[model samples]
Target: MNKIERIRELVEELNKAAIAYYKYDSPIMTDKQYDDLYDELTSLEKETGYILTGSPTQKVQGDVVDNLEKVDHKYPMLSSNKTKDLDVVRIFISDKDAIQSWKLDGLTVVVEYRNGELYKAVTRGNGTVGEDVTHTFKHCVNLPVRLRKPVDITFRGECVIPWDTFERINFELLEPYSHPRNLAAGTLRQLDANIAIERKLEYYVFDIVDGFDSGNLIGDYAYASDLDMPVVEHCAVRDLGEDFNKFNPENFRLPVDGLIYRYDDTEYGKTLGTTSHHPLNMLALKWQDQLYETTLTDIEWNTSKTGLINPVAIFEPVDLDGAITTRATLHNVSYIEDLELGIGDSIMVYRANMVIPKVHENLTKSNTWELPDKCPCCGGEVKIHNENGSKTLHCCNDGCQAKLLSRLTHYVSKNALNIDGFSEATIEKFMELGWLSSLSDIYTLQDHKNEMKVLDGFGNKSTEKLLTAIEKSKTTTLGRYLYGLSIPLIGRTASKSIGKYFKGDYSKFIEALENAFDFSQLEDFGDTMNMNIHRWYVKYSNVEDAYIPKLLEFDTPKFDSIVDNSSDLSGKVFVVTGSLEHYSNREDLVAVIESLGGKVSGSVSAKTSYLINNDSLSNSSKNKKAKEMDVPIIMEKEFLHLIGN
Candidate 1:
């Protein structure tokens, strides 16, 4: 084979190996085999100057834009004709070799390439027009920024977030997104490309609109995949049911709604034409939800960190997908009313996307469920909160055990008090035993050493360690103590700034509060933050049992005072953006920079000594601005090295 033909073959083999390994967790090539082929491809491309758009060596570029602009598509982005019946799919592909693949559940995107480089990407807004999302599209890790051969081409694909990625993101969030598709769509439309990069969106090319004429749908997919562009997993099949059974959601990575079947012959499909709504060439087989009927046993009211009481429906256990589920969140009071749930009422339940258990329909509709007038955790008065036409229950009592649990959890966290072995569960158990009521009670836990040692999950040694950690926490920095107090608008960064301004002396901080000193004088402390600080201080100080800093000793570190401008970073201005590895967030990094007597700016300018972004190659607005002004752009590790870290 010629060099160009060999390059195409090598690209196809390498991409197939990558898909098998990364997507399926099944490796078809040995590590050495993959590497050797990759090296050979790299050398061949360098020698011939013939790089395919989907080459593995290509660096994907990303850009940040201010907003999404509307664009007209060269081809109308029509949907596929859909049905829930297998018979309909069979009829569509009767006696003809057809291509079948997963009907992916994600944001449909049309990507266009000009001169072998990605030029534009747009969402399927309507049939003829779409919102340009090229900025975020470029951030997609699996998306090819350039295709082999310098030619204009258009392809359609679905930009999807993997189930694991979705779960991981939602796990860290208080109010999680309901579905992966929703998160994917939101991430793709984000004005900042970094959001898409952070989410790690993947695009799988399913159809080609121009440039390549493969004569068949499967041929098109093969050609696209060989070009190094990710293609949807497909197979040539004459029977829909025979191939349908092969798909198991348990083994799949991407969220799929159902299966899609299309005519193999492209020319023959064109003869069938299209409807006003969708193309007749392809038929989408949507999965019918499997539901189980069960009795509604009870409704559990769970209080959140913010004192909101959420309702959870408890029903007779029913097997959904593969797991037995007995409970599902009712969301709020409005949802319960909408479902008209009642004890012992019959209801139908199913897993949405075969993942989240949901109540499909309430058959009985008894409407006997009543709202609780008291808090489930503290027996305190409850009030209905009407937010955006939806009614939610909130615990009115400030000292509700559930609310106290949240505060205590944060108080003993590593970033706050650095208390060891004080898990939220342990704290709750201690609170339940009437050993803890306020922040001061934490120090008093030593009084219950004998009792605590005898408790379950706590031996004499474990109890002693907890007491030691608590005692050691009493000599922490003033910044930590302030953050532990959970003051409104006073986070770790703000608290640290305040602590530094006062020389890490608790007395000076208290004196400033007493004299009504304006907190907005501090860096990054706005008028709203100042108001929140004063309001929180006034309310907290008025409480008779508030946390007393006199019980603890504040650290006076040598570098505690920001007034001393002797650091190497002094007189320098840095602009930090994107995600961080060493620091928790941008605010954390900013605090360190400020502590070293350096200034931080929101934008890159002539005064910017350096722009700190982990993704140095990113074409984000900040990076672009820094380049235009000749400002040095450094990665997190390089910046750390500069500061002697």
Candidate 2:
């Protein structure tokens, strides 16, 4: 096909893939293949000067960014709450020292107001940056579209798709979105803002990011209650002190995943910094969905790696966690036959992480079960393998689909390829498209550019981006790729150690592995791990033979940017005590110290840099700590200047 024709075809495929994967959770391409194909299509389009109308390359999933300019928020509303049950939330609230409340089910947005005029509105996209939805915001029902009174203000709020109206919608023109969150996200990004107006989305204001008088405002959250504007509810706590009423009139509306807690005093807020993922102020209470028991009637054997035979229980339908339970994965064949479980045995099952249930025991042991003599998937004859004299059934067929899925999962996990934008949906898509089987197929996606565009969400541009991402990934740290290869027990830390020893030279490592050299000779190499790695390389020789060449062809990632010292304030602790200025934000300052491996203290002690005062010099516990410890007090600017990032 000509380049233009090829580009057009690929875009169509990508569109289909996007729809199926995003909307249906059924996908047809692996992220790796998709990335490669996407890259090729983009190159083709650029070469042919032909971008299709239905191209994902031209748009971001049927939505286009607005023309409005971005305005920096004087205050950033870090995201909050991610739970569904009120019982757990109630328990958390009962235990918390203090709490605030608001609607949990709304699209969070930041609104900019200058001199009391509504100027702009932005939707929270990825927590850091947001989409400009000013025009759509004007059409939203709850927002006045114009201010009721004149005041210089820049505030944040949430716009939600209410459950009632959300359920009522049954339009022929609308997409059959599975949830309100999806519908709301799609609506806010509509090309015609008027279409968003038809959706009945509403807004509720909360934090004030910036305004003319914002600088002079005290940190009293209750004062916002009297400002004649909708404010999100939250209470400050001196401690998880004397458990206070966290739930008030303001608490019920939000559809929350969990509750949020912040130090009430601005001075206290400053002392607490952030972790890599969360701020020190908040503690998230995840609702644990545990497993419950049901009667087990039958057992099914599943063969896995290391030839361990697993027994699954067929049980009476019962509810455990959220979903109804019908089966539990029996860890081993011995586990099943050992239970003496029969056709009418009562059994117990439980779920952890709400993912899987385990068949613990048969309450009523009716009779024993027999082991299957044949492989379930391929009908291959099964053999009894004696592991340390304990017998387990093994299927000679090593290419079972279920087993492959589990193996592939390990290959693409966080420790492995570390391929960004790869989701389980994408993996299924790649397998369905017949573009992959073994790991090496990951390197050959560029040849299938024409097929990828036909899938949903892949356009010439997107495909190009994916391919770019893949190619960029070709040079990741050697440890990541090695870990990704599913080399048995070669964990991420071990792989890093090996990669550093070889300086990311996979060929040398592969060669050394092939020879079965004495690993005791290698420094810091454990005998068990060395033997394990060597055994893995030998057993998967065919795979290793193919993989090493691919590695040799790609660029290697380095560990050169290592920072070993937090020398600036090492052994000394620091607490943030008040509102920060001069530093870009709390995250930036914390990140700087953390990058150097320095520790940040949540509570004050003897070792502290000086409690930072954001509250125009307030006396707080952190301040007292600084005084008692003879720590030097500093401001945000001074810290920033000291660090000199």
Candidate 3:
């Protein structure tokens, strides 16, 4: 093919390659080849002004993602111009004054507050359309669901879970998370609103997305922290004329694909006109880092407990993003076959999202291919498991290395049954030395005295400590036991309720839970939770087979007070209108109110609660809700008084 055909072919190929790389995690092109083809295409477009119908040059803006609804912003979300040279940043800023701030970690969210209460929270989907996630934001107690005053404003902020929280949760479990950002993102997408509330997700309001300003005010963008608005951090700076050094974009929290430079004067912002796709005044600077290439040594298939096999490319370790990366996830079996990838093949790699180093392009001047016929760890026969056109390779071995300790830990996690002392590190090390095999074998520790001592680090004390910890944990709390059981769809809270409905007896719990399956028998369980309970209970058969007997000793805490199976707030919704006197914060109050079977309202409507209004008289809207619905008007203290603390 000639140059035009070649360019067209390459662009289509690269776009497919990008979709696999970004959208599907099945990368075909190496970074160098993608950059080369992209750069070549750019040069061709610039040289002849012949832009291909679908050239990457025009679409090199952001990663294509899923689980996100494309929502347009009131203001268009634009891509940034990137550079690695700090000197260039200094020059860019020196031309005008600027400020540097610690980039916060988490998800980018747009929240709208109406009449002082939070109206809605949305994800930054495509900078246009976004996913509505007010429910997922239940964890953000720091941000009052209803504001203290009537303020019709749209605020832009990041939804972040602390790195410390992420690490702490993963400390004992095997397969600790790679980063906190992905976890936060996944957590925010959970279907359960109650789960989000329990996750402790925080939102820091940054830019006022929409509000009537007295005048153009950028510096006038007041810090909420100064107002003691439950804020944790803030910063302020002004740009100096072209004399200072360039800024480093890497310094901020929460990973930034780029940075935004806006006029301190909102009026100056209004003055700067817009381009077809971007604003002329507000510039988003992207990061440009150098990349490298390498030859793949091995295609290691790592299977997760969820049964997805991820292809890990083991290559010669080379530095990228300030660290040597020898292994990068090939994503899935389709990724393996799509690239026609094989051992000893040349490929290019680069940091995508500034964190995960991904394979970008393939370099092939000759024909050479190698595919594994057997599992690497157990030498078991492997086969591709496919569903709805998606594929993954699985080791037929029930006891494969991929099913090692980390998998076991996740299987029994608090989400599973929450067995204590079965952390990922300890389990993996035990398995690596051939000390443990199955989940049930974890309870049979004392029988292996000879084997435990033979292991390098193991002595008498460590062995006994493990055994003693296990022994002491016989009577686990209902929630922990249920979550730790590794039952499908049965989380900690769900497990506890199941346990309680059965009077803390394991046998009764198993019988009722299994009977609840079959769909027709399930009235107490919600429709969405139907399949989960069915899959878990049906894993085995017979009343005895379903119940794990003498599995361990355990005890549960009993509630001293009465629990109303029929809730007072069963269908009634409530919105806390002001600062609560009896409850220290909205969260404590929301929890108690919700536990009583009440649905909390975010905005005032015909359906509302006492408003729990401390300033209910001063607040016209709260009063309006009471009048419109003829709802009872009660004070926070009065509500607590009726509850009789």
Q: Assess each prediction's global lDDT (C-alpha) against the native.
A: 0.76, 0.56, 0.57
Where model 3 places Cα greater than 4 Å from the true spot, the runs are 1-214, 219-257, 261-291, 306-308, 352-354, 365-369, 411-421, 428-436, 446-465, 471-539, 542-645
Q: How close is every model to the real structure, measured as TM-score?
A: 0.47, 0.45, 0.47
> RMSD of each candidate?
17.9, 18.3, 14.5
Top lDDT hit: 1
Per-residue alpha-carbon lDDT of model 2 for 1-645, expressed as tens digits? 346546755786676655543433333433323444566776787887877655655544321132333233334445332343445355544543444434344466777766566776776543444556777777777665345557666776777676556666644436454445556656776668878878887666544555433221234343343444555555544444333345532344433333454434334444666533244544444333334667766777765533345677788988653446687656455456667778777776665312335565678877666778787765776787654434567766555544554555566565465555656677668867777665556667778777776779787876776666565556455566777765655666567667655554566676787677665455445666688877766566554343132333334443222232223555555566565554333433454454444566544556555566665356775676567777778776666555552
Error of 1 at 373 (Å): 2.8
**On a 0 to 100 scale, what is the lDDT of residue 501 in model 1?**
73
- For candidate 3, write residues 520-573 as lDDT tens digits: 233234444557666555643323431132233323322112133343556766
TM-score of candidate 1 against the unseen true structure:
0.47
Model 2 regions more than 4 Å off? 1-97, 102-160, 169-229, 233-254, 257-263, 272-375, 379-486, 489-533, 542-645
Candidate 1: regions farther than 4 A off: 1-231, 234-255, 258-292, 414-418, 444-456, 459-461, 467-538, 545-645
Can you give the lDDT of residue 114 in candidate 3?
76
